[model samples]
Target chain A: MSTATNKKTVQLSHGGGGKEMNRLIKDIFFNAFDNPILRNEEDAAKLHFNGNTAFTTDSFTVAPLFFAGGDIGKLAIAGTVNDLAMMGAEPQYLSSSFIIEEGFAIDDLKTIVNSMATELKRSGARIVCGDTKVVPKGCADGIFINTSGVGRILNDHISVKNLQQDDVIIVSRDVGRHGAAILMAREGLALESELTSDCATLWPIVEQLIATNVDIHAMRDATRGGISAVLNEWASASNVGIEVNESAIPVCNEVSGLCELYGFEPFDLANEGTFILAVPKTAAEATLQVMKTFCHCEQAAIIGHVNDRKVGKVILNTPWGSSRYLDVPQGELLPRIC
Target chain B: MSTATNKKTVQLSHGGGGKEMNRLIKDIFFNAFDNPILRNEEDAAKLHFNGNTAFTTDSFTVAPLFFAGGDIGKLAIAGTVNDLAMMGAEPQYLSSSFIIEEGFAIDDLKTIVNSMATELKRSGARIVCGDTKVVPKGCADGIFINTSGVGRILNDHISVKNLQQDDVIIVSRDVGRHGAAILMAREGLALESELTSDCATLWPIVEQLIATNVDIHAMRDATRGGISAVLNEWASASNVGIEVNESAIPVCNEVSGLCELYGFEPFDLANEGTFILAVPKTAAEATLQVMKTFCHCEQAAIIGHVNDRKVGKVILNTPWGSSRYLDVPQGELLPRIC
Candidate 1:
């Protein structure tokens, strides 16, 4: 069958561990995140740590375990580690659980497990424990992964409720890479420019930021509902309003073009690699500088500021010099893009 | 369509969090588990603690968001808290994350969340932090949940490596309840005897066990591959073999009959609410007595013993005077049952 015909539907081949799987991981996920640890393509991630313990867990069931920029294996590890990073933690260990569809290819599973081991080693994390279960074929789409991570918290004050007035909001690198990549992968929309999913571990960038000792109030990895959801959450949790300069919010040209063509707002899309930092306004520049030292975050910028007025609200200054309310994206703008 | 006509197919209605959902939770989950925390149907479990912290994480993605015993919400809380309990910890706090499908019903979502809150209260655990993501409809089966728990570790020396030669293996209550329940739910099988999934929290039983001070070496919930898988894991981890007296192993009559007819070994089936304990052979009777104080564990029994011979192996003595090897069930025999 031609690639076009096959492209419209997700087949078991998409999840098969082979050349296609490698292409999917490198071309989409690697291209977007572009970090040394991830690029190394090892079985586990190697990390450095300093303080108290931090733990988090995440599960990925992105339909078509094999997606445009990544697969469930990569997504699972990245997601959990990012949560630890958000806490300014140095990830140390991970426990993975697999819920596989009965009849899932054993070879395919081995491939995924191998990839996970590689990613874990590369990120400086170890798989200390794991659980596997098989459900009847029709009961699951293909495969789902649950990863629980433990990290050493480098900074004790890093928390969602730590934000204060005058804190600046800095976004790491560009937004919408993950959302757009998954969209293109699912819709089969070919563009002159290909968009890759920004699925990656943010520990390195987070580690660098912590080392700088720049005052950070809170940090969140913008995953689902993109920047919009995270900002709203931060505003609500910190009891502060946020105002963003639209032009300062970075978005890759390819992603911007795709979002425009698809009638989706980039702010509402998910981003696996991007993080929002709420820092003391005076420390914002230093934070951005430290973040930029990491290639994945070279384009980091202070896009917004926490304000005293309109607490619990997020406002975006439009390109036309108009301000608009940025609410939590009501539902999924782009599904399964993780 | 008539219910009979819908056989062999699972629909979104199964996960809708309404009457059908209640029936599934009660008839299947509650019947098997039959615990006070679950029967109370409150907003969070009221647990008493004495100085130690407990921690655990569980991620659930049943093809049908809702299942025979419970939805991802209840499963998320129960699964994680149980893990903490197995470690002789008192569950106190929990964190939950949801991967929701874009088109999932808002009402259903609310119900699931509320149910989770209720289960948490019933288990005496609090939902302290959480996250939500929406994946496009086809990108996810429906809704998947990952829950991590923090509890105080009350007892010391509960590690698997603590197992000693001649330690007796005690199982709390009947085996294979959860697996059989899921099978019946999936197959839509009806019989004179009803079998429900034993999906419930075991914190109370575990807490009682710890209080009795019976020289427990290790404890594990018999999930996924069931009692056999857990025993095998214990043996391998502790560098010992487990020899079980077949007649001493407790199996519900209905579950036994179902296993026989389906060509399944009860030992290989999953049981969410059941746990395996390795205690000094001399303390087995006392442990069983403590277990009886918990209503759900009235059928607790001393079924096996840890031995130096056949290290890292699991041996079962049959009623017919034959000995057979019980290996980890290769691959998943039942999917999404947990």
Candidate 2:
């Protein structure tokens, strides 16, 4: 009930809004996410925004907390900020809230907080406000974080409804690494080389595309439902058919091998940092060029084009000159992969 | 792993970014929080905000999802919205994210979502954006909701640090009802008269105060650590002493009784809808006059005054002609208290 604790694990008082909670917040969160807006110490953060802004929220309950390459903390920040970036917005401010289960390791908490601080540097976003709640033991697994963010839209023209006919689709890199990595970690699969999650922040690449004036019509990270989900939604929203050459879509060998082993489709698996973009056919080359200059994006390629045929559907062209309707992913691909 | 289930409970595939998940979102969440912004179905909500805005985030893990007077959904919306209101901001757009444990009842989700929609009507705030994830059963308690909100600041001078030496402190109404109500609900205590949490939207009263142009110095909801916590923070933030008349402070008989039974201080109990305000001594009567017009604020009264005597401290003067330093709460009073 007081400050005294096992030191190895979190205590109920660590979230009690008292001296101990103050210590944890200060020693860990405040120290890592130190910023003027956060240091203001008000109930809500004061922000100045002009014109249009993008707001988004995401909750990360990824199992194992720590995966092959990233932890839940990294995914939490990247995922929310990426939502802003996909809207052609500059990631600016974020709010982090933690739901910690009693008796969870304190050292692990520090590590997660540190990962969050490190991830913030990827997009220059600041965590301005946060809340911590400790539940009774067994009430929660370990820790779950909910991050919400807002940023000014640098290019207001980007939207899922803006995918015009003849717009070319580009995958930022090889798809499905995130889902595969988590699967591998959870199933204890061994491979010749370790496969890490593609959980890096995509803002820098997005910023470059904006700088180059690539005429981005629609941008979305292949998270949760993965590329298939994003494409299906775009097709239905814009009332356009998307045709993709299966041979052209980038898929790393590790991801392909894992998909084969697990009887899953690479396009249906989640990707934390990977994104799919819709740009005018004329901007395809330029978009790919700009994307390839970024780390982990060397495999970026133009793989599809929007059309009026097969409205509200995605058609995938195979290597043998055959095609099939690429349906929206269905039924429990994976839970808590994010 | 498709939509087939017991019909009364939620399934894992409902969060798998597939047909089932889309159906769940539309049938439950979207149906309850119907609006153009939410219907757009974009990854993030597009909002236009000019000038200064107040942003806040809160995660609600309150146990017994349904409690006296309000549920967790109501608490989630009101808690974040209240933070904005306390900063003299108009509650506008809110983002809600949910972390659900697999196999939870679907009917319960509908009830919670409905509660959130009804609460949104309290301040006309729109649910502009949201996220949902389902963790395997036992990974989460039942459901945890995180709400992040942003709104235009109506009175920019409202801040804890803005407290002045002669500012009078006003207690919005009788305090400790929320904390006591939750306790009673959890313990299944039998009481002749029903006691409910003071959980209601405060923006209506706050808007009126702003419209009247009362020189508001500091405003804060006594949420987690209650009035004692807010006063201590204000005193420390402004380096001013606060002298509170114990007799003038309002405490309902129900709350006072529960406080005595639990060995808890009424002032130290959390309040969901109650707030404390510091205004110029000359405007105390005007503020009370405006507040009393509201439904739940009939007991509004001036409870204390700011002083220069004991900097960074709150002195509680009892009717016995003795005073004691009211310290900031320092231990776990109750966990998962909104």
Candidate 3:
């Protein structure tokens, strides 16, 4: 195939581990994600490590490839980095792997890769190594990205089972924006307000919280199953009861409107950038202050508190003075939301 | 869906970040790849590291899922581990991410997970963290797996750019078995002899080579683009010329026969378990003796030598004494052969 034609789309030979593959990698991935370790061009990247490290992985297969606020590339980077940041680690090195359809547009791939490079810069993480595979057109959708990251843990006190009685619960931002955004894109709904997915890297806010040495008992991003999943998991893992004032939880008008239209609970929708935290009541104010400094996390608030009663359960109290169990989502609320 | 039906096949809800997703993960992934690090049930796995490390990643989308010698799960582990091993690192921890098509058989999933567990034992590596995504039916093929690995470097001397003049080039066992085996399986050719893919992990053999303390210049697995690709890379990277005796490279009967029928060069065919090494002529005897101790490397021999005359080129000397340049394999030899 002519080089001009090759530049237009991804062909099978582009992933064939030959000349075409080499040129594509160098021209795109290497050029955008250039770093000393990557330039070595070895099968693996050589790195130095000391002390405790946090490792995590995530795969992004969101439909539409590009959604409001962020695309799959941005999600891939932020998702993995957030996982490490949740553990109070400084996001460092990441390995990206792509599974692309043969006829996918090269322009789109370059856009995605460039987005990834941009996202990596937010937390100073580098794409040190990566792999690419191309399957026949119908064998896969447009593309899927898997990012695995490793970082040195700055604080080792965060754990899923670290909640204690009287610890205050905080939400980093309004929940369900990611799910609402993807749903809107999929359904072709052009709302007047132009709602976007809350997809972003949480490392900046997380780094501040760690730097301030807030006694963070547990921290987790509300991803696939949303805040309900995080609250429910914390209760079960720590064997504590979590009582949340439903009205105190922040939710954007767009997400609440979409949830009502689809008969879905806001707590059940996913959020890419939102997170939940459990900290001693004394540290809750400081944590919220640090989080609110970030533009997207300005809505951070104390929505709940941990207690010993009703162990292993999450209770949601309504504004009407009634309460119900805020159970973990039971069915598929949304697929490929992040 | 009924519980029985749900047990028979994976449902979208199983990856929905809900109770069902929790059960699926605990029942399958956690139960098989059990380890303390994985059991922590956090967004990231906490690990301790010191000194130099090697990191790499790969995504496997091989067709047929299962071949004569191994399945996708085995290939996923072996491939990533080999990348680290080729860098003279002892494979330690791995992160697995799976993108599955909705409605894939649960039985097949179990078999694949079990194979992964079995393969992990071969290199003493743990699946410390993982992610799973399920796409709608027809959005993906059966499944694609991405594995990212981290290991401690056992020897820092091996590198693609470390080859030097008079370095003896060695091949571990036969070339082209993996490509030919996948092709046979794809074509459904019932060859009388079983021609299994050389899909074994290389850590054990590599560990011995390192322990022997034999001087080594560089090493790489003859994977996707095969030995020809490695020779060209080494020559280009180290600014040296590589001259190979074509007849000295081992080629099994089945692979040779299949290559002849398909009009493919053995040097350009992929091999999963086989590898190439560069060592000084003085250390060639010890290197070959150590390699031959393993059954698969019984035919290991010196295939060529590095010289300074023809930098950035690989020349092949045929049995008839005519020399030809064995250029890097330029086209797609086989897709998803890993």
DockQ of each: 0.14, 0.88, 0.88
What ranges in model 2 sit over 4 Å off? A1-5, A190-192, B1-5, B190-192
Model 2 per-residue lDDT tens digits across residues A1-338: 44356577787778877777878888889999999999989999999998999999999999879988899999999999999999999999999999999999888999999999999999999999999999989999999999999999999999989999999999989989899998987887735447889998899999999998889999999998889999999999999999999999888899999899889999999999999999998888899889989999999998899999999999999999999998888889778898
Candidate 2 per-residue lDDT over residues B1-338, each given as its tens digit: 34466467877888999888899999999999999999988888999999999999999999789888999999999998999999999999999999999889888899999999999999999999999999998999999999999999999999989999899999999999888888998888736548899998999999999999999999999988889889999999999999999999999999989888899999999899999999998999999999999999999988999999999999999989999998888878988887
lDDT of 3 at A256: 90
Number of backbone collisions per candidate:
43, 0, 0
What is the C-alpha local distance difference test score of each model?
Answer: 0.69, 0.91, 0.93
Candidate 1 chain A least-lDDT 10 residues: A40-49
Residue A138's lDDT in candidate 2: 95
Order candidates by TM-score, high to low.
Answer: 3, 2, 1
Which portions of model 3 show Cα errors greater than 4 Å? A1-5, B1-3
- Of 1 and 3, the candidate ranking higher by lDDT: 3
Each candidate: RMSD to true structure? 8.8, 1.5, 1.2
Indicate which candidate wins on TM-score. 3
Q: How much is the lDDT of residue A8 in candidate 2? A: 71
